[model samples]
Each structure stands twice: as C-alpha cells, then as structure tokens.
Target: MSGIVEVAAAVMLRANGTEFLLAQRPVGKVYAGYWEFPGGKVEPGESVRQALIRELQEELGITVTECSPWLTRQFTYPHATVRLNFWRATAWTGEIGITAPLEHSAVEWQACGTAATVAPILPANDPILKALALPTTMAITMAESEGVERQLERLEQALQQGLRLIQVRDKGWPPARRLAFAEAVTRLAQAHGALVVINDDAEIARQAGADGLHLSSGQLAACTSRPDFTWVGASCHSAEEIARAGELGLDYALLGPVLPTPSHPESSGLGWPEFGRRLNSNRLPVFALGGMKNELLTAAQNHGAHGIALMRGW
Candidate 1:
C-alpha cells in the first residue's frame, strides 16, 4: 500500500517556568504506555490543526484560542513510520484537568526542564523534548550610531537584566569601529557569563575572541560545517533556509516577519497559524522574528515557536 501517515501534537506550556502537560498511553496502542505530547492521527479530510483541536477537547477538556506549531519530526519503528507536527498550544476556556483517562491512562503538568528525568518518553518525542530545553531568546546588537560608549552601555544594561544570549550584529561599522564594538560586547558578555555571537564577520568574531558566529542566510547556505564555537545561529525566513542552517551544524535560527513590521513594511506577517505550521520543524532552534515583542511570548510559544527574536521584545 502507498500511504503517508501524518500526526500532530501539542506542547501546552505555562510562562512561569512552571510546567507542560503530557499524557500516558493506555493498553494496546502503538507506543502504548509511554508518555507523549497528546495528539492523534489526521483523519479523513482533516488538517493537522483540526485534529489537534479535536484531540485537545477530547483528551484534556481544554478549549484552545491560539496555538503555535513548532517542532516537526519523523520516526520509523518496527511497527510504523510516522510524520509528526508539533504545536505549542494556549488554552482559552475550560480548566485543564485530566477529565477522563478512558483512552489516556493519566495526564499531568510537570515542570518543563525536568522532562528527561521523568523517564518513559516515546523515542520519537525525545529529540523535540531536548530542543525545547534550550533557552529560546537571542539579542542581536543594533548600532544606529557609531557611539561606541553608548552602545557598550546598552549591552551592559541588557546583560544586567539577565540577557544571557546575544549577537554582535555590528555590520555597518567600518572595520576599526566594528572590532572595538565587538571587543566591548565580548567584555560585557564575559563579565555577565553571557554568550555573544558575531554576525557574518567570522574573522572579526574570531579575532575579538567572541563566543561564536551568527551566520546570515547566505552564509548559512554556503557553509559545509559548523564553525568551531560554543554557539552558532542564523537568520532565515523560510523552511528550506532553516533546514540548511541545521545542515551546516548551526545550533539555532531566527525566522520571521510573522507580524507586520516597520522593518519590512512592504511584507506581511506570517500570521500565528501559518507561523506555527511553518515551524513543524525538528531541526535547529527556530525563534520567531520580524516585528516580535515580549507581549507575544505566550502566543509565540503556542504557535510552535521556540521563542521570539526581538529589538523591542526582551
């Protein structure tokens, strides 16, 4: 038989570093008796999104208002080959209690970072679980002016406020100014135990002793292997671009214009639904970009985004 088996899942998470829900399988099912992100097969003429909504209402008694599709993974076992699209769903109505375990044996919302230790995750879910564990934010520096001292102060301020991840995107500066700015940011990052990725200037990033490099989409596509660094990231707007980023051994990617923005006013945002669909990714970290702010974090997560890459958003 010729067939394509499709599936969907939800990573319903809370913002307080609290928890995400998982359900245990019952008897006589594929991957039976293992913990999993609750979801089911795509039914006749039903989209993955529709299947998720139906599954959530049936399994957890929670009505969803918004969902972000994030990770997509494919796995084959002795029993079956499945394509899974994962979404980050946000609850709208109905209290999320384990209403009935008729099909699902039990459900619980345990702390997120501790999932691996919980034991019994289905093998297909393991990679996505690890991807979710990584920190989801990246701060790229902006130099609207050549004032080195002023920029340093900005970097310092961001660092003080728990900005552990950063990128030195000082491209407009002439060579000497760029080097000075990178050096300053690197110093600040070190003092705060933060990691700074230099943008597109591999040589400068290396010379200034930065933590790693942030490749542009062009650079990412051209690379054959990852640069020798502690962290590597890229900027991308499409799925193919993100796949390439992963192929080059990059650690993560910032993808977007998911919302209408002045940065690219001529373009339209990805809208939450499409944004989530695009992310059904199992590759590198994909932080939603393009006109994102902190107010969208819950929405972004629900939509399948690891997090947001922002200028205004922290």
Candidate 2:
C-alpha cells in the first residue's frame, strides 16, 4: 500500500460570528448524506492552497483570499488513503452558499455546538471536530490542601508524566497563601520545563510571575486586550463564545461537557460525534474537558484537539 495519497480539504468558516456553514452530502454516494467540511480533491501538480481556491469555486462558488496554516492531520481508510490538507480560510470573496456542486445535497450554517445538531458526518472527520471542542487544561492547586505541602508536587507529577502545560488555579486563601502558592508553583513548573498560566486572576498571574492567564467564557467578552504574556486560554461552550475568545486573541481554549460526567449529571451533554462537528475548525487550539478519561486521549488527539483537560483522569 502506498502510504497516503495527496489530497486537500478546505475549512471555509465564515467569520460571521455565530454560525459555520456545514454541508450535508447527498444520498447514493460514498459517505453519502454525511456532514463534512466543504472542499474537494486536489488535482495533480496543484498546490494545496491552489486546490483549496479552485475547490471552493467549484463546490460553493466562493473565492479564497487569506488562510491560516493548520495541519488537522492525515487518516487512512480501507478503500483509499487521504492526505487531507486543511486551512482556516478567513479572507474570502463570495459568500459560502452552495452552487450545486456534484455529490452534495443540503447545506446549513449551524451553531457549531448546539444540541439540536445531527449528522451524516464522516467518521474520519469526527476526531478533528472533537478536538476543536476541547478547552486547555486549567488545574487547581491548594495551599497544603489534604496535607499536601508543595503545590508543585501534583504539578510536577503531571508534567513529568507527559503534561505539557496548564493553568494554576487557587482559591480560599489569604494574600500570603495565594502569593506563596503562585510564586512557588510558577517556579516549580518552570524548573520542570512546563508552561504555567494563572486562572482568572491576571493581576496575581502577573505578580506571581506566571506565563499568562486563563478565563471563563463569561470573562472573555470583557477582555479588551490579551495579557502581556506567552500564553492565554479560555473556557467556552457555545461557538459564539469560542469565536469571541478567539477574536480576543486567546492562545487556546477548553470547550466541553462533550460527554455526560459523573460530576454534573443534571444538564444535557454534547455527545462525542456532535462535539467533533462543532469543534472541527475552531480558530483557537482547544483541549477536551469534562469527562475526559485517559483512554480518550488518542481519540481527542485524532480529532484535532491540542490536548485533554481533566479533574480526575490522572
């Protein structure tokens, strides 16, 4: 078997705030009626970007202008291997309404994560979408909670065990406790070669000498400028919030409740498939959160997720 045959795909997301244009495939076709990103095969000798511009014209009658370079990934199937190259094209000419390209039947611009969303979505694309819906991991640390002294102990454990980065969240402490935990954790994570962001407290982050800050979706709208730091992340559920956070120049995000969690059994959850659909081409890097198990990491990574955030999946 020849590895992956070269092909290209376009994630033509309209910067229109709330909705992304999703197309449903027609019946009587391979992966027919499946919902998918809206570009097609690359012709021989054409560059991926060129193929994108041409495919958009053919499929949706749109002209591409500017695109962000992102590698969602390559997946193999039994029938054929697809080396899918994708880009987040922001600058475009015509609107993304379909122009009757062959093999497609219906299209709609839906909120990426609404519960009402359903699918004829292809399975390979699911992982990318799922990853897009996750938010960056923001870990909470205690100042000697449960007789744990060094706040860095857990952090160090996480990092040494392959955790690349995280935010340090601390609450219920005096100024001294807060500062001490922040300062010590900051130094500890840095010494262990990890990036540390502070949770919802920009001032404390700045004072404690952290790498950056993290905010909830509610706080995202209030941010005028990104903090002067190396990293910034946010929490989001809806596509609107995710876009808002992205527009505010957040470095990444955590978006979830993708699956029902033992922690929160009351509210409805976005099952894995629909979660992937909404998150497929999110502007900012997203880490899967809520109900993330260690076993799900491979699934999340395959779906275009940057990583996973967890409360108990250590």
Best by lDDT: 1
The C-alpha RMSD in Å for every predicted model, in order, reads: 4.1, 16.2
For model 1, state the Cα shift of residue 239 in Å. Answer: 4.0
Shift of residue 312 alpha carbon in model 2, Å: 2.0
Q: Against the true structure, whose TM-score is highest? A: 1
Question: How well is each residue in 1-314 modelled by candidate 1, as lDDT tens digits?
Answer: 23657887887777554467778887888667789898888888998789888888887777777776666777786777778888777555776664533357777677754545455878888666656555666676776443667667776787788677777886887888788888888888899877788999888898888988888888877888888886788888787888787667567888888988866788888887887677665466688887887677777776667787876544
Deviation of model 1 at 257, angstroms: 5.5
Error of 1 at 69 (Å): 1.7
- Please give the CA lDDT of all the candidate structures: 0.76, 0.67
Q: For every model in order, what is the number of clashing pairs?
A: 12, 16
- Tell me the spans in candidate 1 whose CA falls farther than 4 Å from its real position: 92-98, 105-115, 134-136, 143-146, 159-164, 172-195, 201-212, 228-230, 246-249, 256-285, 290-292, 295-305, 311-314
Q: Give the Å shift of residue 65 in candidate 2.
A: 30
lDDT at residue 231 of model 1 (Cα atoms)? 71
Model 2 residue runs over 4 Å out of place are 1-151
